[model samples]
Structure formats: C-alpha cells, structure tokens
Target chain A: MESGTARIAVDLLGGDDAPAVVVDGALRAVRADPDLHLLLVGPAEAAGEVIRALDPAQRARVTVRPVRTVVGMADHPVAARADSTVRGAVHAVRDGAADALVSAGSTGATVTAVALGLGRWPDVRRPALIATLPAVAGPVVLLDVGGSLEPRPATLARHAALGTAYAAVAHAVAAPRVGLLSVGTEAGKGDRARRLADPILAATSLPCDGRYVGLVEGYDVSLGARADVVVTDGFTGNVLLKAIEGAYAMAGGPPTGGGAPRAAALLGVAGTVVVCHGAARPEDVAAGIGLAAHLWRRRATDQVRALLDGTEAGDREERTDRTTDTEVPTS
Target chain B: MESGTARIAVDLLGGDDAPAVVVDGALRAVRADPDLHLLLVGPAEAAGEVIRALDPAQRARVTVRPVRTVVGMADHPVAARADSTVRGAVHAVRDGAADALVSAGSTGATVTAVALGLGRWPDVRRPALIATLPAVAGPVVLLDVGGSLEPRPATLARHAALGTAYAAVAHAVAAPRVGLLSVGTEAGKGDRARRLADPILAATSLPCDGRYVGLVEGYDVSLGARADVVVTDGFTGNVLLKAIEGAYAMAGGPPTGGGAPRAAALLGVAGTVVVCHGAARPEDVAAGIGLAAHLWRRRATDQVRALLDGTEAGDREERTDRTTDTEVPTS
Candidate 1:
C-alpha cells in the first residue's frame, strides 16, 4: 500500500503444494499492488505459466529467471545435494536481481540459504523469525518462532534489541515496551534460561527508545496490552504461535481484529526476506509476498541493523564482559 | 452426585475477590449437589452469613473453621499469606475432617502449603498441576501448569508417565496417547530440554497401556487428534492455559464444548487438592470444589499413584539403556 515501487523474488517450487499455489499467489500479489514487480525464480515452465496468464500491461511488470531441476540428481538420496528452489531464490536476492524475497518452503532450508547468501548482520549469531500478531491494543511482535531452537542468554538479550528496533522501524511503535516471555510476571517466575536472561535484559541497553519490561505471560502476546514486543526462545515461540492459532479456531474464529499470522519476516540478514507457513494457502503466500514488498519499501532491514549497531557498540563500551563462547551471532 | 458423603474444605481467604466469591460459590455447590458438605475456612462473620441463609436441612451440611485476621493485618492481605485460610483448608484434609480441598489463592503459596502440610509423595521434588481442556476430538490433559517452573529432562519424562496414568484414571481415556510438547512434530525440533526429553519419553514405558506418540505441536493441544495428553514444563503450560483463556474471551466466548479451565488438579502430593485461578469467579470456584470431590470419590489420586508404582518397578526390572534421575513420589 505504500506509494513506492517494490520488486520481490518469488520461489516457485518452495512450498508443500508449490508451483500451482505459488503461481496463484504471485498473480494475486501482482494484481493487488500496482507499483509491485515480481521476478519469478524457478523452472521455466512454471514461470512461463505466470507470465502468459497476465495481460499485456500486467505482463510488462513480470520477469523470470529460468532454473531447471537436475534430472537423476532428483533421485539421489542426499538432501543437501538436491537442486533446491529456495537456494535459487536466495541467489536472486544476493545477485541484486530482486530487492526482496518470499518463500513458503522448509524453514530450515530457507534460513540456511538466506544466511549463506545474503550474509547475516554482524554480532547476530542466530537470526530470528519474527511474526507480528494483531492484538487488541496494537501489533505484538514475537520473535524466534522457528529460527534457532536453542540460544544462549546473551543471544536472547541481543534478540531483545532486534525485536525493539523491528517494532519501531516496521510497525512504527514508539518507545516500544519489550518483555521476556515467561511462565509468570514475577522476577524469578521461569526456567533457568529465563532467570539468567531476566537480569541480562535488565542490564542491556535497547535501541529506539525501547525499555525492558521485566517479564510477561503468554496472554500478553495475543492481547498486546502488556508489551509491544515479546521475546522468547525459538522453541517456545514457535509452539506458542501455533497454539494461539489453534485457540482461535476452537473459539469459532479469531477476534474481530485478526488472528495469528501464517507468515513471518526473517531478520538479521542483509536483505529483506519473508517466510510463510509450510502449509500456507494461496492467500497466505500472497500475504507473504506483500509483506516482503512492505519491508523492502520501508528499508526496515537497514534501519534495524543500524539501530542494533549503535546498541552493540554501546554495550561493548559499558564493559568488557565475557563475550567469548557466548553463541551471540556475530555475522 | 457419586452417591456418597463428600466433604470439601473451601478456602474463603483465597483468590483476588475472596470470601465474597468463595461464599457465593459454596452456596451454589451446596444447592447443586445434595450430598455435598462444605467446611468453610475464614472469619466467623463471613461464615455466619452463609449459615443464616441456609435452611435447617441445608445447614446440617455446612460447617465453619473461623480464622480471624490479625488486628494490624491488612484487609484481604491475609488472603495472600501462606498461613491463611488456604493452609487451614489443607490441614482439614490432612486431619480427615474433609474428603478434599479447593483453593483459588496464589499458586506458589498454595503449592508450598499443601506440600508441607499433607507431605509430598516420596521421591517427588516438585508436584505438578494438571488441567484438562475439551478439544474437538476429546479432553486434552496438560500437565506441570505452574508446579515446577524449571524441570530437568528426567522430570519431564516422569511427568509423561504421570500424565499417561492420569488420563486413564481421571478421564477414562482408553490407552491414552502421550506427547511431549514442542515447536515441531519432527525430531530435533525443540529447545534443549525438549530435545533431551523426546528420546527419553520414546524409550520409557507408559502405564495403563498408554503409548508415547512422539513430539506434538501446539495446535494438537487444542485439536486433541494427535495425542490425548500433552506434557511440557510448568512455565509453558501455565502461560499457554491463560493465553487460551484470553483468546476465548477475545473470540466473544468459548466454543460450545467449554472454555479453558480455571481449576487444575494438583498431583504428587499425598492428598486430593484442586487449585483455581487467582482471578477465579464464583462459578470457577464452585467448579474447583466439584473437581476435588470428584477426584476424591473416584480415588483417582490413589489409582494414578498405584499405576505409576507398577510402571516404575517394571522399568527398573527391564533396566534398559535409558536412565533417568527423576524422583517418583511414594505415598
């Protein structure tokens, strides 16, 4: 909806029901946004179908990069050697063929491809998959939904900064309140990781006028009254997000505002990237593409990286803490 | 309702809105269950009102244990104290003056009081709080909902057995399918604790003909198609329950079956105990009391303990490669 041209690369063979659903979603995205251009990256046949389906004027906005699956290699028993389409999409962004990328593929493969191709931000050991839930008060940003299963306490503190900056840059939430998701709101109300991270978060400096709000419960993620940003380990975050989605389904439908998102934005990489749920429908893929464009137009990745740079340097100046062996990603 | 005299000790000075809500809930329970007897624990004046309202026939079923507030003590502040009415209610069960006990106080305080007064089952370091939610397929039992915030991998494995037995004895779930809660259903999909527990659960033998069905995602908790009982650390369980409750509220109301439960049954203690949410309403309090009476009448706690005993001994006899340091409570 932003008044700017945004170019995004579409991974045609990335999802469980790829090619067909991806094509349908790309068409929907192209028709919805007048200023949007797409660079479809996949097999020539799949890309041709999308290009031919568009009218003359609409066709002008679309381009294709031919990628052929290696025959005989497909039957090879190795997962790593397969000609993955997600890798092709990552190469498109890395090679400057597209401003951003969207994928509905295996999260591990997409993350691996992006981290390898686009390069991660310096000092971000584990790039997070952030999802924004449309809560009652405003958008509640949750992170590490499926990025790294296990992160150290220092990594969690670093994520707090990333989440804070993302809320300000992408969602425009002023003076965002950041909270660590735990069992209870009390000081010592969680597991050992949370107990260690609580004090670390309190000591760490946050960017974008964000302040740490000790601890919050899972209800805060859906209601958004307690904090604008909720940070947790990827494991808990992933399950919690899906659980909220299921809760909405059981309740008949989501709140009038919206429900848990089926897509998430990958942060800490050099380029803009959005990942949809593996079981996403056509509409979800379209939404992911739109999100990729929005992030690219806002220059969200660069802004968030800049914010993190300032905070990390400030943290270094404060003290020479034991930074070694702390699995805090230094891209 | 179970065709026997069931006396329940109700903690009057528990919960955010104590005495008033507790009184109202007790009145409802007495009216609904003709064979139910109530031992109201709180100030004499609060009990006097309830006694005055009941007819002579109903009055016979009600008794009171007066716990006057100290002169300088803050009003309602007594509700949060560990030695208040909830503690007295626990003692009533210990003295055989009541068949079971119910409280809607601070979870930590209630847990500590019951463990000290009624004594813990030998070998059990932390008790677990179990709640059953009515999902689409059937009742889904979730455990450790605030009992042990940080459980070791062995503790989680122990809970798997407890939950499996509980589903069979309490809910009469036939050969219940147990699952370890995680971010994804695949192996190596969760944080360190979950990753470690997955293999242990897979190797361990479950009681009551139960089977370990591997890892389950959050949606399965609400859908109940994948597993009958879900196991997680206390922190995730507590927050997830509250989040589901909040989601149901945002959805206008709960589904036709019911909403997330306000009351959870306490396991690993030597007595039958049920805990309601701190913000429990009168209806929630009544439900907590009802759950306690039902558990006591069915001898669910005793039966579950027996089943666990047989399983533990069997596990020892097998002496498999997997070894766990988990402590099992001995009655």
Candidate 2:
C-alpha cells in the first residue's frame, strides 16, 4: 500500500526450500506492490525462472545479480563466505542498487552481513532483531530476538531505547510504553539478570515520548495489555516467539490481528534489512520482502539511528550534570 | 475418578483474590470428588463457610486447622513467615494428617515452605516445579517452571533425570524422550548456559527407559513433535508457559488437547505439593486441588524419588567403573 520506488534485494538461495520458494515469493511481492522493485541475488537459473513467470509489464521491475554461493545454516557467520548470496544482497543494498535486503537464510549470516556491509549505529555494541506481534490492543514490538544471545544489563537498556524508537517509527505508535520481560510483574521477581536490568531500564530515558512501565510478565507479550514495547535478551526472545507460534498452531489458527510474524526487521544496522525464518514458506518470504520495502520507504533505519544518537547524547549530558552537582569545592 | 481418599490441605488465604476464591474452590473440589477430604488451613471463618455450604455427607469430609498469618506475594520466603498458611499446609502433609497440599499463593513461599518442611530428595539441591500440558501426542512434562530460576549446568542435568522420571511415573509416558530447551535444535545453537547443558544432558543416564534428545526448540514445548519431556530454566519456563496461555486466549480457546495448565506440581520434595498461579480463578484452584489429589493417589512423589535415586546410583557406579578401568598398575 505504500507509494514509493523501494528497490529490495532478495536472496534466492536462502531458506530450506530456496529458489522455488524465493521465486514464488518474489512473484507475489511484485504483483502486490506497484512501486516495488527486486534485485534477485542468486543463480542465473533461479533468477531467470522468476523473470519468465512475471508478465511483460512486471518484468521491467525485476533485475538479477546472479550470485551462486550461499551461507549454510550451520556455517559460521564470520567464516570465509564473502561471495554468498546474502552477502551479495547486502552489497547490492550498500551500492544503491537496492534500498533494502531480505533473506530467509541463516539469521546469523544475515545479521553479520548487514552489520559488516552497512555498519552499526553509534553507541550500539550489538545490533537487535526486532519482531512485531499483533496483539489485542495493537502491535507489540519485541527486540533482541537472536541478535545478542547473552546481553548484559547495559545492552538490555540500550535495546529498550532501540525498541521504543522502532515502535514509534515503524508502527506509528505514540508515546509507547516499554516494559522489561520477566517471570513476574512484581519489582523483585526474576533471575539475577532481570533483577539487575530492571532498575537500569527504569533509569534510562527512551525516545519518542516512550516511558518505562517497569516489569511485565510473559502474558504482556501476547495480550499487549501492559506495554507496547517489550525488551529481553535474545535467547529468551527467540524461544518465546517460537512458543507463541506453536501455541497458535495448537489453537487451530491465529487471531484476527494475525499470529507471530515469521519475518523480523534487524535494527541497529545502518540500512533497512528484514530476515525471515529459515523454514519460511512462500508467503512468509513474501511478507519479509514486503517488510523490507516498507522499511525502505519509511527510512526507518536511518530515523531510528538518529533518535538513538540523540538519546545517547542526552544521557551523557545528564550524567555530566549529575557529576558536577555531586562535586564539592576543595577551596 | 481415583478411588482412594485423598486428604488435601487447602490454603485458605492465598492468591490475589483470597478467602472468597479459596472458599469457592474448596466447595467445588469437595463436590467433584466423593473420596476427597479437605483440611482448610487458614482462618476458622473461611473453613466454617466451606463446611456450611456442603451437605451432611460432605461436611464430615472437611476439617479445620486454625492459622492466622498469611504470606504476602511480595514477602520474602524465608524471613520470619514460618506460621503462614502455606507453611501450615506443608506441616499438615508432614504430620500425616494430609496426603497432599495445594496453595494458590506465592510460588516462592510455597516452594520454600515445602522444601524446608518435607525436606528435598537426596541428590536434588534445588526442587523442580513440573507442569504437564496436553499436546497432540500426549502429555508434555515441563520442569522448573518457577523453582530454581537460575540453575547451573549440573542442576539442569539433574533436572533432566528428574523430568524423565516424572514423565514416566506421573504421566505414564513410556520411554519418554527428554530434551534441553534452547534457541534452536542445532548442536551449538544456544546461549552459553544451553551450550554447556546440552552435552551434559546427552551424557546423563535417565530412568524409566527415557532417552535424551540432543536439543529442542520452543515449538517442541507446545507441539510435542520432538520430545515428551522438555527441560528448561525456571525463568524461561515460567515466561513460556504464560505466553502460551496468553496465545490460547488470543486464539479464542485452546485445542481439544487443552491449554497451558495454571497448576504445577512441585517435585524433589519428599511430600506432594501443588502450586497454583497467583492469579488463579476458582476453576484453576479446583484444578490445583485436583492435581494434588491425583498426585497423592498415584504416589507420584515417592515413585519419582525412587526412580531418580536409582538413576543417580547407576551414574555413580558407571563413573567408578570408568575410573577403575583407567587406573595404572604401579606394581
């Protein structure tokens, strides 16, 4: 529905059922959005299949990079796989051939490639993978899905700021209420990491009129009755998302708002990038492409970066003023 | 449907909605099972209310244990609250007056009181809270829902054996497959704790013909397509269970297999204890009482302890034989 010439690079050999699924997803995306363009980055045969499947009018909107290599799911992220299709897609985005990139491959490989190609935002030690779930109230944005598996308290506080900014920019949420995910909503109810992160998140300032609503339970993640943005370590976030998906499957299907998304946008990177599930279906891959195009059109990555920078600067200034206030004159 | 009389001590002053909800739950539980007997452990007025509601046949099945103190949800577990209703319920089990105890109170308080009163099993340093979810295949047993929030690698390994025994003894899951919960199913796909616990679980000797599956994702927790017994830290398990419950609510209702349970059994303690969610409704409280009665009738606690002890002894003997085989002849 967005109106803009947003060019997206799709990794043709990424998911478990690659090439075929990617081709189908690419075709679906091209037909859904009139202002969308795709730069297929994979084997020539796969790319040609996509072009041949499209109509003459839609053929003009598709292009190909023709890379063959791929990063396997078990491969190391920083290993010598520079010529992989995902990496090639990242290069296409960096070179301005595409405004954003989408891959249903290894999450680690995609995160590494995007961070290396586009660079990370200032003051961000680790990039965050943000997934938005449609809840009863509205969209609930969860961050650090698999970006940093074991983040410290400071990293969680930093992610709180990123998630807040993303909820406001990507979802058009006003005055987002952010909450820390824990076992219970009580103040002192969690493991050591949560106990440490709770006070830190409470003290940290959030952008876009965002405020910390203190500790929230797992129910808050799906119900969205408590907070708009939920922040946690990547390990917990990743498993929690999958469990919700499985629960929806057990319950026959998802709600009217839709189930947990299979595609998540990688924040803290310098460019708009969306990563789909490794076992994604054609529709999931198409959703990933749509998310990439939407993020590119809205310039969400750059806007979040700018907001984070202002917040960090304000935090530093406040600390400096506090330090000065605590100082006593020796004279 | 269990024929034997199950004497269950009910905590009268527990949960967010106290005496009123407890009174309602007690009446429901007494009427549901004819062989069930109750020892109300709280104010005498609450016990009188429950007795007055029942007919003459059921009136003889109920008794009263006068206790004035109640543990607040935010109160510290071990700090001078020994006379609380949960503690009194534990004492009722310890004194042979009750076969099992159920409380819709603070999980920490219940765990602490039961551990201290009944004493833990020989090799279990931390008690485990186990919850069974009805899945497509059968019941999926998940342990450490709130007990031992931040367990060590050795604790997780010990819990794997405990979970295997529980699945077999409590749920009658023959040859249950145990799995360590992680971000992904790959060998090295998890946080540092999971990476350490994976190999430990693989090497652990299980009881009741249980086998260890390498690793399982969060989906396995609900779907039960991979493993029958899923082991995780209390923190992750607690949140995951609540999230699934919320997802079921979002989906309008649970499947025919049922939803996430609001009541969990506390294992590793010598006596049977069931802890209900702090926000439990009347039916949930009734379910907790029902679970206590079921566990007591089946003697699940004693059976699980015996199985765990055999496994631990076998593990020790295996290590001794290996040590003996590696010894060099100095002569």
Candidate 3:
C-alpha cells in the first residue's frame, strides 16, 4: 500500500496446512498489493501452481526458488527438514532477493534461523516478538510474544526499550506509554520477575520520549486505557495473546476495531521478519506478508533501532548502573 | 435453590461501593433463594437500611453483626483495621453462624482473614482461588486466580489436583481432565515453572477418576474442550480471568450461556468463601452471594477435600514417584 515497491520472501511450507495455505495466501497477497513482489520458497510444483493462477501482468511480479526432496532420505528427521525451509527463507532475505520474509513456521525454528542468519541488534540478548492488539484507546504493543521464553530482568529491561521504540516507529504513536504486564497495577503485584522488572523499567530510559507507566493489568492489553505498550516474559505474553483471541471467539466476535493479531513482528533481529501463528489460515498468512511489506516500506526497523540508540546514550549519561554482570533469571 | 437452608455471611464494607451495593446484593440473594439466610456484617445504620427495605417475613431472615468504628480513628488503616467487616464475616463462619462467606473486598485482606480465622485444610499450603468460566463445551475451572502469586512447580502440581477435585465436586463433572496452562501443548513448551510442572502433573494422581491431560494452550481455558480444569499460577490466572471479562464486555455482552464469572470460589481453606471482583456492581455481588449459597448447599468444600484425601491415599498405596515433595502451603 505504501509508495515504494516491497519484495517479501514467503515460506510455502510453514503453516499447519503448508504449501496449500501458503500458496493461496501468496496469491491473495500479490492480488491485494500492487507494489508487492513475492519470492516463493518451496517445491517447484507448488510454486508452479501460484504462477499459473496469475494473469500475464500479475504473473510478472512473482519469482520462485525451487526446492526438492532428496531420494533415499524417506526417514529423515522432521526437525532437520523443517529447519531447511526456514533457513532458505532467511537466506533469501540475506541475499538481497527479498526486502523481508514472512513465515508461519514453528517460532523456535524461525527465531533460531533468523537470529543466526541475520545477527541480533546490539545490546539485545533475546529477540522479541511484538504483536499489536487493537484496543479501545488505540494499538497496544505487546512484546516477547514467543521469541524468548525465560527472559532475565536485564533482558526484560532491554525489551522495554525495544517495545517502546517499536510502538512509536511502527504505529506512529507520539510519546508512547509503556507498561510492564502483571497481575495487578499496584507495586509488588506480580511474581518475582515482574517485581524486579518494575523498578528497572522505572529507572531505565525509554526511546521516542516513551515513559514507563508502572504495572498494568491484563485488561489493559485489550482495552489500552493504561498503556500503549505492554512488556512481559515471552511465556506469559504468548499465552496471553492467544487467550485474548480465544476470549474474543467465545464472546461471538472482537471489539469494534479488531481481534487479537495472528501475525507478530520479530524485533531485536536485524532483518524484517513477520511470524504468523503456526495454525494460521490462508488469510492470516496473507496478512503476515502484507505486514512485512508495510514494515519494510515504512522503514520501521531502522527507525526503531535509531530510537533505541538515542535511549541507550541517554541512559548511559544519566545512570551509572550499566554493567556487564548478569543477574539471576527470575522468569 | 437447593432443598437445604444455606446461611451466608455477607461482607458489607468490603468493595469499592460497599454497604450500598452489598445491601442491594443481599436483598437480591434473599429473594432468589427462598431457603437462603444472610448474616450482614457492617455498621448498624447500613444493616438497618436493608432491614427496613425488606418485608416483615424477609426481614426475619436477615441478621446483623454491627462493627462499630472508633469516633476519632480517622488515621486508621482501612485494610489493616481488625474490626473490618471481612474479618467479622470470617468470624461468623468460624463461629458456625454462617454456612459460607462472600466478599468483593480487597483480595489480599479477604484471603488473609479467612486463612487466619477459619484455618486452612491440612496438607494445603497456599489456598487457591478458583473461577469457573462458562465455556462452549461446559464450565472450565481455572485455579490459583489470586490466592498465591508466585508458586513453585510443586505448588502448580498441587493446584492441578485442587482444580481437578474442584471441577468434580463443585460442578459435578465425572472424570475431570486437568491441564497445566502453558504457551504450547508440546512436551517442552513453556518457561521454567511450566516446564518443571508439566511432567509432575502428568505423573500426579487426580481425584474423582480425574486424569492429567498434559499441557494446554490459552484457548483451552475458554473452550473447555481440551480440559475440564486448567491450572496455572495465581498471577496468570488472575489476569486471564479479567481479560476474558473485559473481552465479553467489549462484545456488547457475554455469549448465550453468560459472561466470564465475576466471582471465584476459595479452595484449600476449611470454609466456603466466594470472592467477587473489587469493582463489581450490585448485581455481581448478588450473584457472588448466590454462588456461595449454592456451593454451601452442595457441601462443595468438604467434598473436594475428601476427593483429595482419596487421591493422596491411592497415590501412597501405588508407591508412585513422590520425590517432587511439593506441598501446597496453607496460609
């Protein structure tokens, strides 16, 4: 939808109904975005089905990277084979064949492949998966959705910066308010991880003029009245996101704006990567591809990285708590 | 509603809009259940208002335990004041004046007072707060909603048993299936606590012919198809409950069966105690009182304890792996 053309690498064997859903999603994506070009990564036969479906003019926007199954390897490990497709998709982004990548594969496989292929950002130990939920007030950015499960207090503090920066750059929010997710909004309301992270978030400087809003309850993730960005350990964040989606389904539908997002932007990694739910449908995969394209055109990653740099500099000058010493992993 | 008379102690000065909402709630509870009696705990003026509003026959069903405040105690801590109505309500249950107690007060205050006055059940460490959400399949019992904040792996396993027993005794579900709430249903899917608790739950013995069903995702809590009772730490459970409630509210109203429960039953304690949301309205408080009466009539607390005893005895005889040594703390 943006002015500039964005090329995205689509993983055809990523979702539960891989290849079929992925091909269908790719067709939808290409049809929706006139300025979008996709480099399909999968078996040649599946790629051929996508190419044959498009007319001459639309077909010109598509490309394929043919993959095949080697004979005499019928009993190969599933993990090894799954890792190949994700690695190929990551390599496409690294080779300048695509501006970004979209996958609905196992989050661990994608995260590992992406982090290894495209190095992590400086000062970020664990890459964060960020999901934006449509709240009543505005968008609520939730970080560590599934990238890293057991984040230390320092990793959480670092994610606070990442989330604040992402909220401003991706969502175009001015002076975003960040909050640490916990059971209650009161001080000392949550478990050990949250109690320790509270003071650290309060003391740490946030990017984009973002301010830490103490502890926020789960309702704030959907309602967004208290904070624009909610930070938590990946385990809690991932389950909470899915739980909200389920709650919406049980309630008949989502609120006025939208429901819980199926696609999440992988931050803390250098490249533009969008990870959809593993059980995502064709429409969800298409939406993930569209999100990746949008982020690439908006230069969201660059802007967020720059914001974090400024925040890091300010923090260094203001506080003398900077140290390489590791603290206990409370999460 | 049941055949037996159930007298419930209602905490008058417990919620944000105490006395006013509590009085209205008590009136609704009395009207709904012909055999229900209420022991209203608060000031004489507040009790007098409820007494004056009811008909002569209905007024005879209401009794008051007036809690007089000191004339010059403006600096008294409202939560710590020994003469607070929640403590009085707890005392009423301990003195055999009431079959159960219901409060929409501060959760911490209620938990502490109830544990101290009524005493905790043997072999139960931290009592769990259990909330039953009306899901598509049936009622899903979620435990440790707010009773204990950060529980160890053993505590989580114990809560699983507590939830399983609760689902059977309170909801009358046969062979209740229990699941540990986690990010994914895979074997090694969650953070440290869940990773450690998953195997323990799978091995632990469940009551009422209950069985442990490995890890369950967030959707399982709302759908109830995967497990009858979902177990998690109090923090996650608390937030999840509120988020579901908020989702139902945003959807205009709850589904046909009703919305996320505003009340939760307290387990691990000897007495039957029901806690409503602190921000509950008059009708929510009334529903919570009604729930307390219903559970009392069913003798849910005693039945759940007996179920636990049966399971523990069976475990000891089977010589299963009891090396986990996780004890549910009775506060």
i-RMS for every candidate (Å) is: 3.9, 0.6, 4.3
lDDT score at residue A205, model 1, on the 0-100 scale = 93
Q: Can you list the residue pairs that collide in candidate 3?
A: B124-B330, B125-B328, B125-B329, B125-B330, B126-B329
Give lDDT: candidate 1, residue A69. Answer: 48
In CAPRI terms, model 3 is classed as: acceptable
Q: Which ranges in model 1 have alpha carbons more than 4 Å from their true place?
A: A68-83, A320-331, B1-3, B53-56, B68-82, B123-125, B320-331
Q: What share of the true interface contacts does candidate 3 keep?
A: 0.62
* Segments in model 2 whose C-alpha atoms lie over 4 Å from true places: A321-331, B321-331
For model 3 chain A, the run of ten residues with the poorest summed lDDT: A69-78
Candidate 3 C-alpha lDDT tens digits along A1-331:
5768999998887777888999999999999999999999879899899999998899999999875421111222234334367777889999999999998878877877788888899789999999999887789999989888889988998999999988888888889899998877768777888988899899888988899999998888878899999998888888788888888898888888878889999998899999999888888999999999989998998888888888888778655444432333334
Chain A TM-scores in order: 0.92, 0.97, 0.92
Worst 10 residues of 1 chain A by lDDT: A71-80
Candidate 3: which stretches are off by over 4 Å?
A: A68-83, A321-331, B68-81, B318-331
* Most accurate candidate by lDDT: 2
Worst 10 residues of 3 chain B by lDDT: B69-78
Ranking by DockQ: 2, 1, 3
Which 10-residue window in model 1 chain B sums to the lowest lDDT?
A: B69-78
